[model samples]
Target: MKRINTWLISTWAAIIGYFQFFPQDLNNLWQAMPDDIKASLPPYVAKGVAFALFCAMLIGRSVNTHKEKKVLEQKVEDTKDDAAA
Candidate 1:
């Protein structure tokens, strides 16, 4: 379980970190649009939005997992205490 969590966190971190480095492919994707469309926004804005969504999901999942693990740990401890008593 711990190993899984470690791996997940590392994976998310790596993905987010990689995106932080500006890439040409994403720029191309953004620039391949028509001029009228391009006039509406900046290039990095779209990338930023994508990164924000990705980070949100990653953080959300991490928090939920941490909460669940804590709850389960507490339940286990309580059960052990009751058994001992």
Candidate 2:
């Protein structure tokens, strides 16, 4: 269980770190867009969209981590209470 947990954490970290480049990747994808499609959207829209997606990714991870930590904390408190009782 410990090894599996360690592996999961390492993989998760790698995934989160790679997401930091999402905006750059988005820019590259925008460059590859056909002219007609590009013309349909405003230039600044990409920046705004990139900001939102990246921010969501960051916040999502934090929220998930905190939720998990909270759950563990609750479980610990329950165990302590049981032991006291």
Candidate 3:
């Protein structure tokens, strides 16, 4: 179950990473947008936003994993102490 969960999470991260890193040609999409809106948006704003979001997600995931590891380590230590007692 743990392996399956890890695989799924990794798969999702990879998929999102690809989209954020290598965006598809969206000339048609841009063409569809109104000139005023496109003009208002800052150049490279999408790339900046993507990078910010990716960093935020990775940080959150890292924090969660760190907490889980700490808990597991404490549990192992407690078990060893109990065995010695």
lDDT of each: 0.76, 0.71, 0.70
What lDDT does candidate 3 reach at residue 43?
Answer: 47
lDDT of 1 by residue, 1-85 (tens): 7677667767766765766675765676677988887898887687777777667867877898889999999999999999999
Tens-digit lDDT string for candidate 2 (1-85): 4466556556655654654556576567778989998999986786666556656656766787789899999999999999999
Report the CA-based lDDT of candidate 2 relative to the real structure: 0.71
Question: What TM-score fits each model?
Answer: 0.54, 0.58, 0.58
TM-score of 3: 0.58
- In candidate 1, list every pair of residues with a backbone clash: none
Question: Which candidate would rank higher by TM-score, 1 or 2?
Answer: 2
List where candidate 3 sits over 4 angstroms from the true fold: 1-40
Consecutive 10-residue window with the lowest summed lDDT within model 1 = 13-22
Candidate 2, residue 71: how far the Cα is off, in Å:
0.2
Report the error of model 1 at residue 81, Å.
3.4
Q: Give the per-residue lDDT digits (tens) of candidate 3, residues 7-81.
A: 756775675576656566333455577889889986466556656666776677678788999999999999999
Candidates ranked, most accurate by TM-score first: 3, 2, 1
